[model samples]
Target: MSTFTKPNHIGRKISRIRELRNMKQEALAQALGTNQQAVSILENSETIDEDKLIAIAKVLGVTVEAIKSFSEEGMINYFNTFNESDNNFNHYNTCTFNPLDKLVESFEENKKLYERLLKAEQDKIEYLEKLLKGK
Candidate 1:
């Protein structure tokens, strides 16, 4: 038997694009004014409304058609074009941003995620303690 792929899985496409950009669900959720759990559910869905998809694409720095046509093979090929074999790729990738800035940005985002998670745990514990005291 041959395995089949679902070509029209919009949510999976969104997720892949997000991952390729080195973004976390919590970051994306904050950008979308939603929560991480909602983002998780959205990314697991098969489809999204056109308007929302457009908004998501905008936040992702891609066009809706780009997200719609995203594929693993295409992504590989796209990254391959950035290899040293392509002299043109050097100008943009080399001159645009500092590597340390990217590292710091990643660290900041991770810190925010960790803080949010810790606060959530604390809230849960407090609620459970209240219930126990009531009983």
Candidate 2:
């Protein structure tokens, strides 16, 4: 039997991570300064350049290692194992890190990104204003 089997395929891993993050391919493409068709091709690729992979990981809000080691089956298994009786759900799903802590951390990261985007836009406006003054 000859068949291709690559559980750690980075392209597929990126696609899954994007989906889990509730991001569309167009959004990912925009973040990468590319297009939806390019993103589609990327997902179909078996191998990707390291620098590009790092860029994708950044846009996906994950580490390069996280994308490299990602597995669809593993994620399914993790969620499957998380279901428990209603009374014991919280007890059974006790995590090494608090969920609230993760939420707060995500909020902080989003705030930082928002601030950076605002600053960039403000800088662009200032530059345009200077140009107008010159003209």
Per-residue lDDT of model 1, residues 36-135, tens digit only: 9998999998999998898899899999999989889987887787684677756557757788999999999999999999999999999999999999
Candidate 2: tens digits of C-alpha lDDT, residues 1-135: 899864556778888899999999999999999999999999988889999999999999889988988887888888877574555867777789888999999999999999999999999999999999999
TM-score of each: 0.57, 0.57
Give the clash count for each candidate. Answer: 0, 0
State the weakest 10-residue window (summed lDDT) of model 2: 82-91
lDDT score for residue 68 of model 1: 89
Worst 10-residue lDDT window for candidate 1 reads: 84-93
As for candidate 2, its clashing pairs are none
Residue 100 alpha-carbon offset, candidate 1, angstroms: 29
Q: Residue 129 in model 2: shift from native, Å?
A: 70
Colliding pairs, model 1: none
